[model samples]
Every structure is written in C-alpha cells, then in structure tokens.
Target: MILQPDSKVLIQGITADIASTHGSRMKAYGTNIMAGVNPGSGGQIYHDIPSFDLVEQVVAEIGAIDTTLIFVPAYQALDAALEAIAAGIRQIVIISPGMPPLDMVHLLRKAEATETIIVGPNSPGIIIPGKLLLGTHPSEFYTPGSVGIVSRSSTLTYEIALELTKSGIGQSIGVSIGGDTIAGSSFLQWLQMLDEDENTSAIVLVGEPGGNSEEAAARYIAEAIDKPVIAYIAGRKAPAGRHWGHTGTLAMVVGRGEDVGTAQSKLAAFKSAKVPLAERPAQIPELVKKALK
Candidate 1:
C-alpha cells in the first residue's frame, strides 16, 4: 500500500509485561501519536501517547482507529482482534503469535462478519515509512519508493529491506503476512493490490520453507503480471520435521539429517517463472537492481 500522511493507527496491549520492543513502538508512531490501549494502562502512556483500557473506550475518546497493531499475548490475541473489529477498526494487524486454531477460526469469522481487514495473528504487521506502521517491524530500515515488499518472516522483511536500501531501492509498502496458516491476508491479496499500484514498479516476495503459498505466488507471477520481481526463500536445508515458528512453517516432517530443501526448490520455481533469485544477502541488491531494469 502507498502510505499517505493521514493514516491513523492504534496500538493494543501496550504494557510493561510484554513490552520489550519500545524501539519498534517509537518508529511506528512517528509524529502522529494517535492512541494506545492497555486495560490497566489507562493513565500510563508510551512516547507521550494516551492509553486506554478498552477498544470502545479508546474509540470513544480518540475516535475510531483506522488500523491497529495487536501486541497482546497469545491468550488474549483473539479477544484483542475481535475487540478491534467491534471498535470499528478498518484494518487490523496482529503482531502476537501462538494463537490457537480455534481462536483464529473465531477471529476470521468475526472479521468476515464485520468486513474488517486483518493483517496478522502472527506477523510483524504492515508499514509505510514516514506514514503508518502496524505491528513490531522497524521503520528505520525502510524508505518510500517504487518496490513493494511482502514476506512471511518479520526478520526476513527487515533483512531484505536493508539490502534493498543499500541498493538504493526503496519500497512503496512492506507487509509481513505473519507465519500462521489461518493468519490474516495472503501474498496474492497484496500482489493484486501492488500490481494495480502505480507507485509500485516492482515487487519483492520473501517466502519460507513450507506451505504452498510460494508455489501459489509463483503461479500468479507467471500468468498475469509483467512487472519485474525478485525473491529469496529461507530454509534451504531446514530439518524435515522441525516446526520453526508460524503455523505454515512445516508441511511434511520426515527425519533427522533428512532436511527437505525448500528454499532452493521454491526459488527454482520462481526461476522457471523468470523471476530473479538472490542466493545471498549481498546478491539481493544487484539482483533487484537488474530486475527493476
């Protein structure tokens, strides 16, 4: 998404208990201290931003939230998401993970019931530098430009964006789709939007070791779009059965030393679609530069 100046965001579950990434919190708020939510934190504040106990209370005091980044614990994630939807949050991004499948089912049901857009149950959320940031991803590494980034791993999002910045390629928008299977949105959804975005001249997709999302994305890239694309898949040699993080992190777990190489296989598929694949971090800049050409 191309970030504008008027994007308003609300941060939920901002407390001293799970509050570790104050740096991310600062980067996201930027100059617009819209609002913050924490039940017991009514009088407490972060970065000079006001805090509230409930979503409805915050909405009543500060008006409706345009978007929200949920930082509550896994147990409260579902409730937090539902509250945001009920509070009339147009866009919701859940940064917390470990949410149960049943909770996700409930959240998706609630979101669909209200037509609210959910970004993640286990994600870094979405960010547009100098505009709005939802979730915990750092904004210092990003600058607004032409390429749009969407990834399954928050860490990968930062790593890839840093490489792009070093190559002097900025992004129109960057999103972490979260690692949960029943999470929020998908790569295809973001792809369709970016394809229509005039600001986005190209796209960068970062995929992980498991699931058919990469395959699905590759298929879409092959038939419909003509814009330049670059990609890199992690877990080239991941242990067969080891569940890393994310619900979709593993497809089939076999045995020890029998790591089913996925990153290279996925990259091979992208290569068949004629998308540039970067083997190393340093290669990303060069590859993206060439692809955008």
Candidate 2:
C-alpha cells in the first residue's frame, strides 16, 4: 500500500506557489501525479499537470487515483481531504504543517470510517529511496537498500538518512509518521509494516521526547519484530521551569509534562527492549551494522 513509481497522485492545491514549487520537484523525481484540483481553475493547465475544479472531475477524466498529496492551506485541509476521501481516494498525505488538531480529529474519524490511510498534518511524507516519492521528503540523499526508517520528526529523518547514505547504507523505505501529537498513523503501525516488508533487513527509528510512541514501539520490538532495530531520540528536555522553545519543534506536539516523555526515558525504553540505541546520527550505521552481525 505504500507509494510506488506507478501510483496515481492528485494534488489538491497545485496552483499555490508552495505546491507548485514542490509539485515540480516531485514530478521531476518521477511521481505519476495524474492531475490537480484547483476549484475554479478546471479545464486549464498549470505546470503541465491537468487541473480540475473537483476531485470527481479528475477521477472521471483520469480514472481512479491511488493517492492524493494535499498542498492546501491548513484551515482548508479538512475539506480538501474529505473531498478526496469521499471520491474514493484511499491514501491522503497532508503537506500542511500547522493544521488545527481539531481538524485532524474530524479527519481521522472519517478516515477510519472509510478505511482510508491518512499520513500527516505535518508530515514530510514517504519514500522508497530512488524509486518513489511522496510529500516533501528530500530524496537526493537517499539510495535504495535494505534498511527501513520511520520517524516522528521530518528534519531528523533527513539527517539520519543522510548519515546512513554517507556510510554507504541505503534504505528500503523511509517515512515520517507525522510531526503532530495526534498523528494519523503511529510508530507501531509503520514498525509492523517495516517488519513485514521483505526488502527491509533492519530498521531505524528516529524518535523524539513526546508522547508514548517510542515506549510503545519499544514494547512491540521486544515482543514481535524479527529484524534488528536502532533508535535515536532527536532532542532534549527543556530546562525545569522553562517553556518548550524552537529547539522543541518535535516536543511542541507532545507536552513537556513530567513523567510523560524525555530523551532519557525514550532511550531507556529502547535499551530495555534490547534494541540498539544510537545517541548520535553518525553512530546509527555502526550500531545497525553491529546489530545485523
């Protein structure tokens, strides 16, 4: 169900400068972006991709779309996603980062009812190294290989992947589960998928200090995963009595409440689970190599 070279993609806000900029990059990367939905701009062409006023029109003209990468404004994300969902688009990747959590709540309900797969409100999306591209992941630093990467932080994902790439390791697939606290998908879900994937020989989990996601994944790895895993928690806890700052973009989604999450807590969870814990990005490949031994 992951994005592939042939997956038909629809862009919801293809006309926006942000969308067009990234959309062109995605297209250049070989994504089969079938058409775009730009409301009144139907029957026109923009960036050489066919444009439509509605999701249904695109479907009728170009046929069933397998995935939709939405570039619409945060406030309008709900409507764009719901429209795509109602029209039978099963996979939705929201590129908007500041989407209201309440809107995500409403979107998730419908997604569940329709058996849809919602990737993120703040996701950098997913990729299979050199083969497929979706959302905003920078694919240049990646090369196709046997490792699988799943993370909650987009910037951290890129950094880790770059490190892996530099060490001559390649990834089978990599995904940003979501940057928000209430993500559409979860650490456990992507972990299970990676575990089942035949292409994946090992996994890299890029976690942060927020939520129980790392703890949950740690438990799953201890009990279920057949492959080796290396984890790196990306940030530190704020100073006592201080509020979360920009250094806590990953922490912003999950609160800094005591007993909830911390770098030590998540790192300890992986240690207890018997997964290799890499304290630095440069150490991941070495740890992964040792684990695979």
Candidate with best lDDT: 2
Model 2 residue runs over 4 Å out of place are 240-257
Judging by TM-score against the true structure, name the best candidate.
Answer: 2
Worst 10 residues of 1 by lDDT: 252-261
In angstroms, what RMSD does candidate 1 have relative to the true structure?
3.2
Residue-level lDDT of model 1, residues 1-293, one tens digit each, is 32445666677876644442552465445624477788887877676667788889978887866777788888889888888887888688788887787888888888788887788778887777656665566778988788889888888899888888877888888898888766677888888888888888888888887666787788899988677778878776666555555655444543322233256557778988888887765677787777766
Per-candidate local distance difference test: 0.74, 0.84
RMSD of each: 3.2, 2.4
Q: For candidate 2, lDDT tens digit of each residue in 1-293?
A: 75679999999998998777777778898999888889899887878887899999989888999999988888999999999998999999888877887898999999999999988878888888887888788888898999999988888898888898999999998898777656888888888888899899999998876667788899999999889989998765545323222223334345545555666667788889988888789999898888778
Clashing pairs in 1: none
